[model samples]
Target: MTIFLGGRSRADTGNVISMDRFRSGRSVSPIRQAEAYWSALRRHGDVPNRSDIDPRGLENILEYTFILERIAPGVARFRLAGNHLSRIVGMEVRGMPMTALFSAMARAEAAATLEHIFLAPAIAELSLISGTNSRAVSQVEARAILLPLKNDLGEISRALGVLVADGPLGAGGLRFDIAGSNLRKLDIRPDRSPAEPVPGLAEDQAPIRRNAPGLRVVSRED
Candidate 1:
């Protein structure tokens, strides 16, 4: 996979480190581990299937990992989330839109980024910063990665992700702004086509389901 570091912009002035540097810095071990696991699952240049994920494979980073289900264009919700994610938002995050963790101004961009991952079937690594007004009140720095996955029907509608933060999570209800992002398109063989647009994929809005005691990997039967 090719890696590119994004340049600092006015909005991301506080983001001094780019994704490439962040990866090399080796501070976010969970992100790296998750990427390695996802990469190892690929066969014949195709994305891994959701059912193929075994919680044991991610035991080390399970608390920082999550699964997402695409529900609409540019929209996805957490199918499962680890404890660290709940701690960040001060609530269980299952069934909540992924953008809920982002600031209002950042949601649009975050949604677009999510869409690109599913539509292009690409892998994305994002640099995030969370604090009051995105200026680091708690001085939290985070790295997140999104790896596409296929559903039981063989459609690219799921994702496996990892989010790790460094610094004191002083308070609950933290929201992050995207500092930088890098995307690598997957190599889909001519025998397999990219995911097609599915109509009526949006589910009815329902209450967030409470998770069990720990991280649970759903099988195809569920």
Candidate 2:
């Protein structure tokens, strides 16, 4: 497997890997498959709704798939997660904050990156490294992607993601550090309508005042 690590300018053409390479291989990368699935759902540059997702579409990569719900600024908790994530954390990870998988030093950045995904409503690709301590038994590298999703209420507070790690996962829970990241802002067409109407009640029409300027208020019973 080709591990892409280190600093590469986002503008560099080499930073982008073609999906064709995986097509030529026996097994395609789960990350690429997840991305392709998400991209296919987009219509006219609009973000896909969470309801539109179907597990059958991601059958091959479901083990690496997850769904996140934004709870607060820069914070998100896993709404649904797969076995691969549980294996890394050594526990059921559903309902846990997504930052739980990151080392203390990396959590802040991870949270910030997550916030950007929902706020900018962008797509993010991240590179991660774990088990790099001197006493660690093995080093594991990973690639993950975050694709924004709209909830039933039409709020952009949900996300669909996939994380795929390469290398032997050492015993115990693993915490990864952010190695690199890239963001692609969603291209929302100007003509696209708002996901939902303005919150609260609709505007009320003001009562008209008579031209006499001395209108008196009277109860109907009177």
Candidate 3:
């Protein structure tokens, strides 16, 4: 498997951290953990307004979750997730344009990742750092990813993101897992779309059933 990591010790090799570790280190998959998050939404018997989600829950998931915004035409409200592969951080991010979260280069990197997600009809993962405000770089490190969520129109609508604050230094393994669930919840927009994302990026070229859970890819003409 392709290795995605922060600063890991050799012991971390072959030792992937599962989602069950949020409280105590346990073996769990991102999707399974998201199952708990979705149950929270189910409890509300509604989409659980962003305001309703507890900040603690968001932070817990964020430690090993994925999230994103749909502010733009192809994005989500503020930040959202598959509920299986990610968790929420501070919705303090509400109303804040994604660009405001990072530097010029960081913004460009974020945009490029977003563009790839749009083009491929798939998800894109990456690590993030808050700002240099912290004298210790490790204190502000945040690893995250951008995932696409679609509306009824068969076009991208909302986005799913996962964020984890890596203290002085992050972990050496993937904290969460990605599977069939996000395959449907996330997509990579082809470079050629109404939004005119960055060009020449190849993305997820598979068809997914959005109304239900679990994801399976079906090849489609690009």
Candidate 4:
């Protein structure tokens, strides 16, 4: 597997501090709201377990939601997917590599991001576009979210995800063409250390709080 390095220790090899492709914006869709709801469940620095997810709680966004299970280092497969996800591919998406939904060109990066999410226990958000091809002529644009989840054993090898298409989808089988992606590493460590003070700020001066929660990858096509 390809390895990415960050400034921290080997123990943190599973994590990254940040990346350049991140952007901050308003949360406009039901999918984004779902992510916020998931965030609200984290109490006492615990990564929410798959068992903790209640399908009814996501009824509004349920069609866009999904769950993934890590099968190997840096690899995850769909354990369950929503109707909206199945409709995009014109078939059930369970048991497939999460990359199956991505365009050929974007699959590698998508896989890498999944790895980052699992190993680093990060939250990943992506802006995606689907290719125009036979059976599906019109292109589709969408957004996707992947958040880390713990398994029954408490290992951070599961993910909770959601995909929301911005426009009407073509009837033909469709796949994603990644446009941009952002990753935010969560500090779910049990200790939950306080953030260090920024330089040049007075001890009494409150540090400017930026809502940035992640790193990112801007697609060349964008």
Cα lDDT tens digits, model 1, 1-222, are: 543333445455465456654434443788889889988998887899999899999999899999999999889999999999988887899999999889897788788888889988899988888846643356577889999999999999999999987766655678888778777888888555568657789566877667856768899999
Off by over 4 Å in 2: 1-28, 131-136, 190-222
Rank candidates, TM-score, best first.
Answer: 1, 2, 4, 3
Model 4 residue 25 lDDT score = 35
Query: Distance (Å) between predicted and true CA of 167, model 4?
Result: 2.1
Over 4 Å off in model 1, which ranges?
Answer: 1-16, 20-27, 131-137, 190-222
* Candidate 3, superposed: residue stretches over 4 Å from native: 1-69, 73-91, 134-138, 168-222
Model 4 TM-score, 2 decimals: 0.71
- The best candidate in terms of lDDT: 1
lDDT for model 3, on a 0 to 1 scale?
0.42
Model 2, residue 42: distance off in Å is 1.3
TM-score result, candidate 3:
0.41
The ten-residue window of minimal lDDT in model 1 covers 1-10
- Per residue, candidate 4 scores C-alpha lDDT tens digits across 1-222 of 223322234355333323222233322365577788788778786788889899888888888889999898657888998898888888888998888887776677787888899887788877676776525656666778888888888898999998876555667478876666567788766865788888888468567656545755669996
- TM-scores, all candidates, are 0.76, 0.74, 0.41, 0.71
Model 4 clash tally?
3
lDDT of 3 by residue, 129-221 (tens): 444442342434444444454544545544555544445332222121221011122322344536655677857687865756665566896
lDDT of 2 at 158: 94
